[model samples]
Target: MPEKIDYLKKIRELTQEYFQISLDDIPIPETELVNIEPDRADGLLVGSKEALNYQYLVQGDITPFLNKAPEGYFLIGFWGHGFNSYGFYYSRVEPNSRIFFRLPYGGAYMNNKREAIRIKNFLINFFEFKNKLKTATTFNVVESMGEGFHEIKYKDQTVKFKGSVYRQRNPEKHFQKILKSLKVPTKRHQHIIKLPSWAGKKYEDMTPKEQEEYQEHLRRKFTWEPGDLKKVGHEPLTEDEKKLVESIKKQEEDVNKE
Candidate 1:
């Protein structure tokens, strides 16, 4: 309970710093909580590795907080790890809205359309996974192996699976297969998939920084250069990449018309 509170406090402080906020202006009141366990309701999770602790919280929908938040304060939440280390992510909501994600002590993606879509998908799947956890007959966590797994018992059968902690490749399809075998309802969490409003904005309206970020996402998504076929071998793109190329073309057309 105290851990969660401390993390939230740190997260708020980091957010203030990121936004260059003056604490005196906001006047944060003392927050009272009847049950700290409810903090996990928003996709928060706790994990331990050796002597360090990890706290993960996903703020899927930040609209409710916007009215009370200080101007230019667009923070959603954070992924806190260890006692002294924490990383925060932010999202924008107005025109040219975007979400920025930072990897732990690594690279970050800014105002990226693909990342926004990825986060949206993750939040949807994650909340549904949390919902599915409630029906399990028994749930246990294991960490002896390299990457730990969960042993979940639903009805007459037991299955072992790993949680999706912002991984690029996940066993969600496999998990869905298990849930299907258990006759689980898949459409119970439509409301939980709320992303920032106006996720895709006009290219001309985007700030210079956001335009760079958008182009970076495209570069990352479509790795092949114009003459890559001659210089280096390239594998055929997946269906998703084809769609992305088409969308990029459409965006260019939209920009030309403007």
Candidate 2:
């Protein structure tokens, strides 16, 4: 197990080195560090909340931390149980030598999967830019949802396909076709809207004009929903599903009333 004292010391050392400020300079009150257990892998770090807020200010907004980070820098956060936290680390040298700094109450208000996906996507894009300034960088997304784990990788050219889980080792051939269809000058947004699995069959059966209309319909509806179009594409919500959504919305309102 990691020692609380050791982790706190390391955090202080890292913050001083990266931000050029001692732990005392941070805005979070010292008393907040009391419950942090360094030895535990999952426990929060002392002063992490303050450090994260400071980083956002220094970096000129969360974009740098959210998108492609420069080489020698990375952001880490914890998410689960109705909150998301933020923090950043940077390397002074390679191989086990780095600095870690955190922000205060970083996880306080955020609590949802959509928010998590948006944050993660932004960070991945940022990292992609940083990696590309050198040689081409390989982009990978890994998901570990308790029961299963999956990973997908894409080359620099394919970064346009933003949220896709399909790994394309050679995405060049289909690049132009995808670009023309999506009507976007940048490839980075490809993963943003995924066609349903049944889209192929449905698209094939329809006339060219029908396909165009269908594609346009989807372009206007820009929300994220899992499963291919065959299951839950651009079709209107079912009456039952709509009622469930309404019910949940009312429940939310009732909770807010209290």
TM-score between model 2 and native: 0.21
Model 2, CA-based lDDT: 0.37
What TM-score would every model get versus the actual structure?
0.30, 0.21
| 119: Cα error in model 1, Å | 3.5
**Per-residue alpha-carbon lDDT of candidate 2 for residues 1-258, written as tens digits (9 for 90 to 100):** 964355556666755454444545432322333223333235434333333333322223333433443333333323122344333322111122222222222345634333334333333443333333233233233212211111112332443333222123232333334434434344364556877543545445677776556555544543334332223355676554454344545565689799
Cα lDDT of model 1 by residue, 1-258, tens digit: 454355445544754554343333332223331112223333121111210221222233322322332323233344443342333333322221222233232114343344334444444454456457566665543221022345567778776665434444553665577677667666655566764332466655678787667665665555444534121226675554455556666676689799
**Top TM-score model:** 1
Task: Go through the candidates in order and give the C-alpha RMSD of each one to the true structure.
Answer: 21.8, 22.2
Which window of 10 residues has the lowest lDDT sum in candidate 2?
Answer: 143-152
> Model 1 — which ten-residue stretch has the worst lDDT?
45-54
The alpha-carbon deviation from the true structure for residue 215 of candidate 2, after best TM-score superposition, in angstroms, is 46
